[model samples]
Target: MNITRFFIQGNEACARGAIKAGCKFFAGYPITPSTEVAEDAAIILPKEGGTFIQMEDEISALGAVIGAAWAGVKGMTATSGPGFSLMQEHIGYAAMTETPLVIVDVQRGSPSTAQPTMASQSDMMQARWGSHGDYEIIALVPSSVQECFDFTVEAFNLAEKYRVPVIVLSDEIIGHMREKINIPDKVEIIARKMPEEGPETFLPYKAEPDGVSPMPPFGAGYKIHVTGLTHDERGYPDASNPETHTKLVKRLCNKILNHRGELTRVKELYTEDADIIVVSYGAPSRSAITAVKNAREKGIKAGHIKLEIVWPFPEEIIRSAAQQASDIIVAEMNLGQMVYEVERVVKSDAEVSLLPKIGGQIHRPEEFLEMIYKCQK
Candidate 1:
């Protein structure tokens, strides 16, 4: 596969990536930092014989995507801050119904539309635990325009591969940043595994050997019922038996956890033989990496754990890095979301501190450098 380089914005690349990933339907509202995604999709999807719908609201946008996915088309939606909140219910619905859809959240300042145009990584925790239920979510945070494109495709692949929603957790800075991105001419792509047998013999929720049930489209003659409530193997609402509830829940989580090796994706920089480790993700990781290099030049034993996949926590990687470091500092735009996860992974063995700053501004390299120096002392 030959990679081709071109200057492109992150949001534009995301739309192109989805098209390449076989996305045939796009339903979304216009929102800052993410509007480019919808704009591009509107122009490109139709040209590619795909459908693009400008829904009235974010809720409807997500609902349309879910509806399209059940119709056996690769579907997606893009939004930021408040819109992300509006789509939570549908996201939960996707979780329960096991619909394969990709959600692109080009995150902005939050709580209630704090900043529309400014960038923020505040949604890291929200993306993971926003939906009101117990289900595993796969989220990828891209640091650059290239990763923005690459991870968007991966998000769709993971969604279809696992029969769950996969979120591309991007922020305003990365979403809007124009950079030279090398998109491959021939890239590896994965599609949903459809059922081989007839619809009469199909069980929509029947667990496969990989824990992911074969997906049957809505119009595929498979009379499967999809609901938010706990369901049986045949997709009927089954809340009567506790065992049925437990099994379904286990399958939902196990589909991802049991295949963690295939789902977990991360990138590390200079973690070996480091006394201080800085954990960061998304656009903030760019500054964190710069801080690490500058700290090393000043003879500080600094390294970084840049997260590519935010959800599922990456406990083993965090624990292993924490064990090797004397201190771990979590730098994020939110006050203290990922810091809590760092503390849980490191326990009491290492000093874990929160270097959080919110309200649309990113952490500067000097800010992280100061934290490293203070931790060393």
Candidate 2:
């Protein structure tokens, strides 16, 4: 078997992963930390028989991606905090329409672009509830360059499978970092399920028991109605009907939430007999995991839970860890976003504390160790 290896930036790996996952359309606006994802997509996509377009802004970039998805091609876009904020409306649009596309947000210090070239995980909550209406979306966080590739592939697969927008929640640190990663020649590719019936008999939003409808491409002779308003199974706008709105919205959220067991992905170490657990995601996990390892070396019963899939937030994992551990330390590059979810889930089962690092820096290993020691005390 021929093996390929390359030492590349996380952004470049993400582009390559999208290409591998059958992403044939990329529409994006350049922003710091995430610009290289579009840069590499521009360089690699054409060679792979794909199209790359730089839209006027983040809104149109995602608009183009949503357009491409309806046209039967896998689509993707990448951006940072401000751009991500711009794409929120379209994110909701994609959810209401059940359009399958991948969005990569290489987060930076924010509010209003506080730090462009620095790292942050402050976008965690935004990724979950950024849009106006209620909907569920899948988000994957990659700690290493290898996961940058792997999770991008997974993001596309999940998007196509669930017929929802999937976000790659990368930060500046992982987006710009360089490392060697193995490129497997063949990766499992999952395409959207097409309708079995003819176009005349199709109901575009009619779903199976799993709450996911079969998506038919635009040119596939299917006359489909796609809209952002409350839509029925026929995809027609029924904005005034309360029942239609409730059913549509619930399915939009539950299509992902109901499959929580399948969507939640985390990496655990030393959790079996741990007294303290450090929970983290994105770039902060890199430090949190190391600290847990060092704590173990010092005879501390510390464990680590690295969140690979950030949303539909992994409640069960934290709850189980809380049951086994006396204290849980939540490490993140923000002022306590996901820690709140951890606290909510753990809720008196275990003492939950936040170990936050903001303003463009990540938590150091020693900081996590100190927190673990403090928790122990």
Q: In terms of lDDT, which candidate is strongest? A: 2
Clashes of each: 0, 0
Candidate 1 displacement at residue 119 in angstroms: 1.1
**Weakest 10 consecutive residues of candidate 1 by summed lDDT:** 184-193
Model 1 CA lDDT for position 188 = 62
Q: Least lDDT summed over 10 consecutive residues: which range in candidate 2?
A: 1-10
**What TM-score does candidate 2 reach?**
0.99
Computed on alpha carbons, the lDDT of every model, listed in order, comes to: 0.89, 0.93
lDDT of 1 at 225: 89
> Residue-wise lDDT of candidate 1 within 241-304, one digit each (tens)?
8999999988888888888776667788889989999999988899999999999999898999
Question: For every candidate structure, what is the RMSD over all alpha carbons to the true structure, in angstroms?
Answer: 1.2, 0.8
Write down the lDDT that model 1 would get: 0.89
Q: Identify the leading candidate in terms of TM-score.
A: 2
